[model samples]
Target: MLPPPLNHTSSILVIGAGTWGCSTALHLARRGYKNVTVLDPYGVPSPIAAGNDVNKIMEHKELRDSNPDARSIAFATCTRAALNGWKNDPVFMPFFHETGVIVSGSTPDLIRHIEKDEIDSSKGDFITLKTAQDFRNTMPPGVLTGDFPGWKGWFSKEGAGWIHAQKAMLSAHREAKRLGVKFVVDDPTGNVVGLIYQNGDVTGAKTADGTVHRADQVILAAGAGSDRLLDFKKQLRPTAWTLSHIRMTPEEAKRYRDLPVLFNIAKGFFMEPDEDNHELKICDEHPGYCNFIPDPNHPGEKRSLPFAKHQIPLEAEARARDFLRDTMPHLADRPFSFARICWDADTPDRAFLIDRHPEHPSLLIAVGGSGNGAMQMPTIGGFISDALEGKLQKELKYVVRWRPETAVDRDWHSTQNRFGGPDKVMDFQDVKENEWTRINETEKSKKSI
Candidate 1:
């Protein structure tokens, strides 16, 4: 049976003040949903949220799924809306840098997808660049001095670049607050421990401090930490990817500032440096990592969990160095400012999980970022709110619907469209003593959380 429809005065509690949570609150408020409360361990731009970063790639045509499904097509539509918002929305425009994007060295399948997109939707904006010089010609004269070698792919001049991620998230949080969305950021009260149930229906959430924040509806948007609170029946696996930053001088930042976002599926990708901090961020493209810890909800079962740490694996650092040496050799040997392993919940098909719980009528789940969540930020909430209102389009509803049947066992490793990284998922604790990029004294002493 369907739960009662939510009204504006209904008490709506959103857990995890991360990207999806904040976006949902903002959209809900904009839609006149009053009495909405958001709970999190921190305020806007939570340290744990994957979107909380120096910058992230803006929307681009090359990142679309090769064999598009109904869900992929729906997300593509969302990407169109997101591009419009990034270009015109006052809240997000200032942070979007439309420097265009050059995708190179991708797998054969992705290359085919690029070729197809060029023919189907380029409209003269998306075209092929077959050589390293071809890639460099797109940027100003002084940027991208690397030996492009095997780098050859497509480029699109419209609706692509990087966005100041942290600032964008903060902007959303502020707007949501201005719309009268209440936020709780204190520990115990903000730290959600579990859900409160009444007669088999979720009635509220219990925080770490023994307080139960009752609500008429509860939405779980806790990116990777969802498994710790409730069992998703092996549908969601917490996985992580590593990213590092290179500190650059003011002049260097300026020289490289106009470079289009450089991406290589097999090697890695990097974007312009932070204008103020001048920290050039680079991420190693990989299948992602898994850290198996005891599942809190299921006492005897062990599931992959995310461990918040600043140190990254030594192999990850090596990969980053290799990418830099090949692309921007000047900064290849530069010591990293720091590194982090960002975590996200992985669904088997890389599609999002956004549907009401089959058994718990009062609960809704909105997660499974699968590394594509950041680009959909501007419009993802609309889908969630529509789903909550029982008005989501039929095509998308099935894509994000709750389906435990797709759940794989603990031995499952993601092989879907992943090109780089090792075939097997690396266990967090499997790294030996010296196999970590321990940058500082604090990082060296911190073994595990």
Candidate 2:
């Protein structure tokens, strides 16, 4: 027999209906929290922007770089959980491809890391290549032939793969609805007090039409728009990333159709096969060009866009074309058909911020996933659920500690000690005044208990 649901009036309000927000809502619901609500001013899964596309490419770049030291065990744990969820859920299965992933770079160390055997293969396959020829061999016919000079990386047969982002989001939304989570589309005008808060705790969000609802807790997974909900005017920064769907001609598609996701480390270009559509989704890992535009609500508030200039660098396109030609020689002259962009919220250290608010303990903030949010959505939501319930797993504990602030403090103290600075020593009093330090301590206490 299953445990009885927690009989409480504490409803949970989740802001943003995108992948992260929706996923969080779904996870909470699965955990027996019935009164969960999701809010997004723009409605479910906001339109994909150029910035979002580029950030996706950069995420693959990070995987290729494979800084094991930088790996967030929390993220990995969540990714595993999400993968398991998809594997068990019939609705999400079709959207996921088990074709596996391949990574190629110039550095042997990078290749070794990419192909590391000890890495978790439960999500998918992983392989590393010692030579360019080894990398060439993995591709289907017309993929590679010439002596491409680069280190090679390959995915294991059981390695992680990609999902159609829009499709996955839609499925999650459908699932959330099926599980009885309510979605409210509204512009709250920044009046979060009566709408989402009741007696200093999350009740339920009020719609713009003035209908008041109550909930047990409120979760902030609003992505870039999180700042608006939390009044984090200066704390959050919205960044843009780009992605391009280049349709290869029949001949090109025929030659490279079977290629798994490919990351060319030397040129910083990555390509994935959109099998059903016969398009080669390509993008670069570089930050690309960005511009800051004003936010309508705040006078000085600005959001960044990857294609504010609306220009694609010729050099970047050439590099992508060259990679395709060298890696899969069949589509050398194939013209690209279409492309799109998206955005992501990035912290200074590029780590996600997933913890309860310092002042607003009832409000959980789950944004700033940077680019890896989509890939790690399932696991992230599960961990959030764990944290909220005060039952954080060991893996989640690792991620909580890896927050940018904690990492920065650790580095700062190490540097201070290295320099023999007497004044650099920190005390509990100093730590108590620091918000991040307090968060870390809270996490520590939670783990201890």
Candidate 3:
């Protein structure tokens, strides 16, 4: 059942100031909602949030799914809405870079699937890249110097690019603040510990310092950590992917300045280098890792928690190297300047979980990013706000509705784009000292949670 409808003057308490949380605050304020408070362990653009990165892939096109199912259609619609916001919204324009994207893979079936998708979607500008030379033709002669052996994919300038992630979050934070959203960022005050319930209804949240903040409605947008606050009964599986950055010289960065984002299913992906720092980020393709520990809230049960360690597993580094070796051999051996694991809250079906708690009516669950939170930042807040107002579009509400029954028997294998199962996802406990990359002095100074 949906929670009661909210009013303009309702006291809303939002936990977690990550991408989704800040967006929720901004959208609520835009809709004339008064008295909204956002609490987080860190300030806007929290260093630990997955979206608080140098850059992230953005989809701008209206690519329809081949299957045309309701869930896939919902995803496509939401992405189009977000792209619209990114293109026209003043707060997001400065951070968007529509440099285009190249989706390449060595698998034959995957390649054919992509080809069919382009044809069925009726995208006229999609460029087919069948050979290494073909892939390089998209960029200048000097760029993509590596031999893209056996690479088969397509390039589209119509609806793909990357965004300045951290900066975007900062901008949204500033905009939300401009609209009078209160932010509690201090350690004890922002570190929410539990929900405050009365008469079988949630009324507020209690922080680490024992500060109980009362509210007419409470929104849980904690991203990966949402499961820790309240058990979703396995509806949310906390997972993490690995990312590393290669530092390049100013001249080297200039050569690759406007290069499109490159993605290969079997290897990895990389976007344009950061203009200011000249660091090109890359990530390996594989099933994300899970860090399971005894649940503090539920002593006898285990939970997957987000680990903020700056160093990544050696295997992750090796995969990144393999991707670079195949596409950009010159930089394959170059040691990473920095590396870290980005956490995400994944649902079994990869759709978002944005509905009210069936038991606790006043508490709303607005999580399940499934690694697509960055792209949805622009319009996710509107979806969340609509849910609170009891007017969310039927398509979106239907896909994101709360359902514990589906959680009982999760089939991670059915999740799209994921390649492996439990055997592939490395457990945090199994990572040995030798398996971890050396942490530099800069990263050493930063403490892990």
Report clashes for each candidate as comma-separated counts: 0, 36, 0
lDDT of 3 by residue, 1-449 (tens): 44556789899999999999999999999999889999988877776788888899996545455557777777887888898888999988888889888877776775676566533336546778888888788887766778777678778786678998888888889999999999998578998989898888889999999999999999999999887788788788888888998888999898888888988865789998997778899999887888878878768766677868778999889889988888888899987888888998988788999998888888989999898888888889999998888788998899999977777756433334564223266677778878899957674454221
State the local distance difference test value for candidate 1.
0.80
Regions of candidate 1 where Cα sits further than 4 Å from its true position: 60-68, 106-124, 294-301, 408-411, 441-449
lDDT of each: 0.80, 0.53, 0.83
Candidate 2 TM-score to native: 0.69
TM-score of 3: 0.93
Task: Report RMSD for candidate 1.
Answer: 3.3
- State every prediction's TM-score relative to the real structure: 0.92, 0.69, 0.93
Compared with the true structure, what per-residue lDDT tens digits does model 2 show for residues 333-397? 55544433345665545566776665566666777776567766545677777766657765455
Output the TM-score of candidate 1: 0.92
Candidates in order: C-alpha RMSD to true structure: 3.3, 12.5, 2.6
A best-first ranking of the candidates according to their TM-score comes to 3, 1, 2
Q: Residue-wise lDDT of candidate 1 within 199-224, one digit each (tens)?
A: 88898998988889999989999999
Please give the distance, in angstroms, between residue 8's alpha carbon in candidate 2 and its true position after superposition.
5.4
Leading candidate by lDDT: 3
